[model samples]
Target: MKLLLTSGGITNDSIHAALEDLLGMPVGEADALVVPTAQWGHPMCGPASVRGLVAATPSFRHFTALPWASLGVLELTALPTVGKDRWVPWVEAADVLLVDGGDATYLAHWLRESGLAALLPELHGTVWVGMSAGSMALTPRIGQDFVEWAGAPDDRTLGVVDFSIFPHLGAFPGNSLEHAERWAADLDNPAYALDEQSALTVVDGVVDVVSEGEWHLLRS
Candidate 1:
């Protein structure tokens, strides 16, 4: 499976270029799957803003939020709300899975509660794109120190990779690289802090930098 794990949105030219490379020619080109970790189809969200972020241009496939997943049962629905008619098909017919940015803790819980957490790795044979919390949520643990939210955190994760990802690296002070370094030092694990415009692409378990932004690996 081709995985494009990004720090945040496709806000940089290098990131965009890599994304285009992942999407080959049309027709045989892969379908797209969009999972929003932040806001579900909110107007202001990056996933909702881009043209191919969720679906094909001029037309698309959309699947509205499925029933809350909590354990053993899987919920299936053909109903289309909002743009599901345009969004659902893409999901059903995609060669790619795009995970948008949002609250990492909430997103991780939702995926676990819904049981989609187990199906992530099987999404190979196609491109798997994750941005911001989408990317961080795939790790064994997430950086929750800076986020302010309610409810308990679910340690359940996709485990596609074994690292804690911190988004908005240098974008702010709360979750900056320095903070990540300190946190990682305390935990004594390899941690990566990605800037808003940066991304880390992992293909077949191998990882490499994708953008011009900087990333710091904390030391204990």
Candidate 2:
């Protein structure tokens, strides 16, 4: 399956253009959208968060009607307002799964606790698309030193890919490289340091890097 991964929100013109090129038609064309409610910046309803994002982002705002019509929406939040069974349709019927940015650690824990973690990869035709925390959640490990929105302090991740992704590394607080270096040395595995506007897409086992700035691969 194809996996489209992005660093974070496009804050630059060049980066926005690149993201549009790769994502194609904003998020409106997606077959299914799984937005973690835990990641909403504000305490809004799940559907409201989705609507808010589309409204706030010009690229996504216009496609609101299209996305709602063609795709099923699932809100995986701190707790489900709807039953977990409602998520099956989107998870099972999706050709593309669009994940929004949030807290990686919380997203990971929610997926595991709700039993969706084991079900995601089993999707026969689903193409996974992720951004920021959504991207980080797909990897086996991720740096949580920057924020602790959810889960335990020593939370181990959902082991999807055997690496930690350092999203928005250029914006990491304190010594970014030093912290990354220390994490790499401690984990003894490859770590992805994605700058803002950068992306890493993995499709059918092929990994592609796209960025307007720079991205780094740190290995212990």
Candidate 3:
């Protein structure tokens, strides 16, 4: 699978182009399935936040608002109960998975529990577009600073890539450069700090950063 890990959504032209490159076609020609399971794990997100994301409301214009050939919701929490016969095809048919943000640990749990994580190896053509915690879910760790879910056992995640991420750089209070430095120091591994306009694309085994705004490779 191709990875477009982001702190925010496709908020700039470069990121949008990167998304197209990953899709091998225009976004309008690609079918998309949105994973909103992460939203359920955060205290700041709930019915309203999920609704905004699903509805492509103004606040979420950066994401679901992109013109997709078709759009559908894929609640990971519900996938386990529905059985693979019903949901596997839905996942396989989509060109990309638009994973929204929230709590990485909680999202990791459902991804594994729903069998989605196990299925990733088969989706060689699928592009994974992740935002915030959505992006973090693929990393080895998100660091303690970003843990917002009370139920998470730890900051560890899927580690699909060999690094960590410090998201929302300078966008939110307490998420300034100083905070990212501390976060990266504690991580003691390869890491990046992405502003809203920044994104990291991984294809095969190579990684590239695409940004129109600030981004920092805190650790090599």
Candidate 4:
């Protein structure tokens, strides 16, 4: 799988171009499956927020709002109940997975429970476009500072990637670079602090940054 992890979504021309390069085609020619599962686990998100995201409202323009050949929702929360036979094809058939942001632990838990984590190794060409906690779910740890779901055992996640991520740098009052420095101190691995216009791409184990704004790689 190819990973395009973002603090915000595709917020700039450079990131958008990188996404197309990863897709191996134009965005308008690709099919996408939107994953809003993480939203359900967050206290600040509910039906309305998820609706806004899925519907591609202006507030979520950085994410699901993009134009694609086809767009569908793959709710991870509902995957287990329906059986993998049905859902697997849906995932396999899509060109990209637009994973939205929310609680990383919760999203990680459901990814495992839904068997998607196990299935990842087989998705040779799938592009996983993740934003915020969607991106964090792939890292080793999110740092307890980013944990919002009370049900999470700890800050641990899938660790599909070696590093951690501090998303939305400076987007919120508490997400400044100084705040990211504080968060990185407690983490044992390398990490990146990404601003809204930045993103990181991992393809075949090689990583590269795609940014038009600001980003920092905080080495462990």
Could you arrange the candidates by lDDT from highest to lowest? 3, 4, 2, 1
Task: Please report the TM-score between candidate 4 and the true structure.
Answer: 0.98
Candidate 3 lDDT over 1-220, as tens digits, reads 9999999999999999999999999999999999999988999999999999999888988889889999899999998888999999999999999999999999999999999999998999999999999999999999987788898888999989998988899998899999999889988679999999999999997999999999999999
lDDT tens readout by residue for model 2, 113-219: 66677777676566566767777777766654534663456545666766667777667585377776776665645677777667776755656677777677887
lDDT of candidates 1 onward, in order:
0.56, 0.61, 0.93, 0.93
Clashes of each: 14, 0, 0, 0
Tens digit of lDDT per residue, candidate 1, span 36-143?
Answer: 444432334454444343333332221112111111111111122234455334444566566765555666666765545555566555666677766866776664
| Per-residue accuracy of model 4 over 1-220 as CA lDDT, tens digit each | 9999998999999999999999999998999999999998899999999999888889987778888898899999889999988999999999999998989999999999999999998998899999999999999999998888899999999999999999998899999999999999999999999999999999999999999999999865
State how far residue 134 of model 4 sits from its true place (Å).
0.6
lDDT of 2 at 191: 73
* Ten contiguous residues with the weakest lDDT in model 4: 60-69
Q: What's every prediction's RMSD, in angstroms?
A: 8.2, 4.7, 0.7, 0.8
What lDDT does candidate 2 reach at residue 75?
Answer: 57
- Is 1 or 2 the stronger prediction by lDDT? 2
What is the C-alpha local distance difference test score of candidate 1?
A: 0.56
